[model samples]
Target: MDEKIVFKPIGYIKSPFEDVKNMPKSTRESMDVEAEMIINEEYLESMSSMEVGEEYMVLFHFHKSEGFKQRVPFMGNGPIKGLFSTHAPNRPNPIGVSTIRITEINGNVIKFNGVDMLNGTPVLDIKDIL
Candidate 1:
């Protein structure tokens, strides 16, 4: 029997980026953007004991990228490569993962930096990187 799995976002990501075209042309090191993780009420309790000045791995869904391209040109390099081999947003499962530095934490909201996701993206999970 074929089985299917589904997932619901535990939170939402808020950022200054409104469109994917405006995302930084470079990776994490070159971007100094700020963003926030507004977690759902049900997951608030799980954030307890998380300290300030820490980092976490954020997994999120790129709801905007719907079509998949078999090959695309690399961002910096000018050669076309398979979608899976490059970090192009288009994919079967457009999930984005990034490690960000926690700037502050207030209640269910986590303020952070080094954000690369578009505004209102659904966050799948957050893992402490201690």
Candidate 2:
């Protein structure tokens, strides 16, 4: 089926990294960094089951990223590697997923660590790891 799939953002990320440059390579690399996921009011109920200290895989859009290349320099410095092999933001669908731990939850806001996304990044979904 040649149908297009659409998704609405459940929230937006508040991060320190306003630009892609100098950001950590992965969430694991930025465990010390703090961030916030401000869930839309309507989606607030969806996170009621979540608790502080839990880990969830957050899916988000690479809003600032553009198109992708089939081959790219690994880590922007290493030998050339296929796009899928690296965690580059550019992709056929500019979507990013990171497992982050909840540090605090207040009202519709979620404070977390392991931030690798840019400020104001659109969050698509959040899934429990276990």
Candidate 3:
């Protein structure tokens, strides 16, 4: 494996959360929050298999996160712990994964829930929640 890797966004999130502080602290807390995934036209064909009513694992880029601390407060206010032990956005690789439900799919747009991301966060990929 390479020491570094890169990726391009397959889509972007459209949500009411414009700021991190306003977004849900945990993925479960955002379970019912409505949001849209605006897929790129080039990837429309690939999205054909995405079924509505199914749960998916969404991987996204945490573009707004700053530097990480080796020890960060768990849950943002709990005891400080190793970064690996916490799901903090600030990390060496600012990638975030959330389990979301697929409520609707219209053309290249997917209307889903369980959003803990900001409005313009880049969606890296989607996988079946197995």
Candidate 2 has which clashing residue pairs, if any?
none
Ten residues in sequence with the least summed lDDT for candidate 1: 24-33
Task: Say which prediction, candidate 2 or candidate 3, comes out ahead on lDDT.
Answer: 2
Writing each residue's lDDT as its tens digit, candidate 2 over 15-100 gives 99988887888987999999999999998779889999999999999999988899988877899999999988999999999999
Q: Pick the candidate with the highest lDDT.
A: 2
- The true-versus-predicted C-alpha distance at residue 83 of model 3, in Å, is 0.8
95: Cα error in model 2, Å: 0.7
lDDT of 1 by residue, 10-121 (tens): 9998888897777764437424677889999899889997777787888888788878888888863569988777777778778777888888899999988878888998
**Candidate 2: global Cα-lDDT?**
0.93
Q: How much is 74 displaced in model 2, in angstroms?
A: 2.2
Measured with C-alpha atoms, the lDDT of residue 14 in candidate 1 is 88
Candidate ordering by lDDT (highest first): 2, 3, 1
lDDT of 3 at 107: 98
Model 2: residue 104 alpha-carbon error in angstroms: 0.1
Q: Stretches of candidate 3 above 4 Å error?
A: none
